[model samples]
Target: MSTTPPPDISFEQDALGRLILIAPGGTRHVNVHPAKMFPLTEKDHWISIQSENSREILCVEDPQTLPEPSRSLLLGALARRDFVPIIQVIHRIVRMADGHQWHVTTDRGDTTFEVETDESIQNLGHGRLVIVDRRNTRYLIPSVPSLDRVSKRKLEHYY
Candidate 1:
């Protein structure tokens, strides 16, 4: 069994001038502005923190399961003086189609996507792809081009 303790949580800034919270699981809550404090509370299966400007809360469960690079990045940001904390949400998964599409979302209402790889698929079952969001969050998708199906419209636009 592993002997590592739960990851430490900290708030810091990214290169985009947004405030972010580094959770124990290597998951980063980004787009946080300075002078903002996220309200933290522990629940049954997860820990949640709310954004200072909005009521939305990000939650993480068993944060120790996060990978190493994310943990290191968070630690580095906290140690740096210029870093700020911002909240962001990322979801990575392989989507099946003709090419690879990488999508990124931020709290500032900016969305970007680009083609990462291009190839023809004869059989998708043999392909294994890793999709990463933010920095630490990841998921497995069968194909790369399927990400385009996601709607880029904001939640507020519908409400």
Candidate 2:
């Protein structure tokens, strides 16, 4: 970890909920987004600051070291950017020659995604599961055992 001075990070939102970033160069009206350089391992240590157009502005080496308000603001934006709906109900899991189809209900609503194979569902050690679809979107099943009996039975063939 760098012991260097922390970069000034701050933010504001427009009427449409668009983000505005404040920096030493002055406030820039950007659709700024927070991207973790390491999503699973480091979590909050390194982050990429990108614009709405997906352009990289800068990378913060450590968020925990930022000044109080700045740290909170950056973390809040990161939290929103990292939103992933949890699958609560697995209505069905269909196996196919090419791929598998999943019909499930998430915290957000009902949705379906295709998984290329049973390998797509990763057993994250313990009861947790993470399913990556064909398009690369991830559906988090926080705990496999916590799922309803029907979902567990359907998920058995995969893991």
Model number with the top lDDT? 2
How much does each candidate deviate from the true structure in C-alpha RMSD?
A: 15.6, 3.8
Each model's backbone clash number: 21, 0
> What does the lDDT come to for candidate 1?
0.39
Report lDDT (CA) for all predictions. 0.39, 0.79
**Poorest 10 consecutive residues by lDDT, candidate 2:** 1-10
Off by over 4 Å in 1: 1-13, 16-30, 33-45, 52-54, 72-159
Models 1 onward score TM values of 0.22, 0.68
lDDT of 1 by residue, 1-159 (tens): 122333465555667756576655776767632211221122122433445565444444443354565444433433442222221433442454743444444434434343333322122243323333333333333333332344212211211
Model 2 lDDT vs. the true structure?
0.79
Per-residue lDDT tens digits for candidate 2, residues 1-159, read: 222346655666678766677755575847788788766557768788787788777778887888766688778888877856799999998878899889999999999989998788888767878898998887888888899999999888765
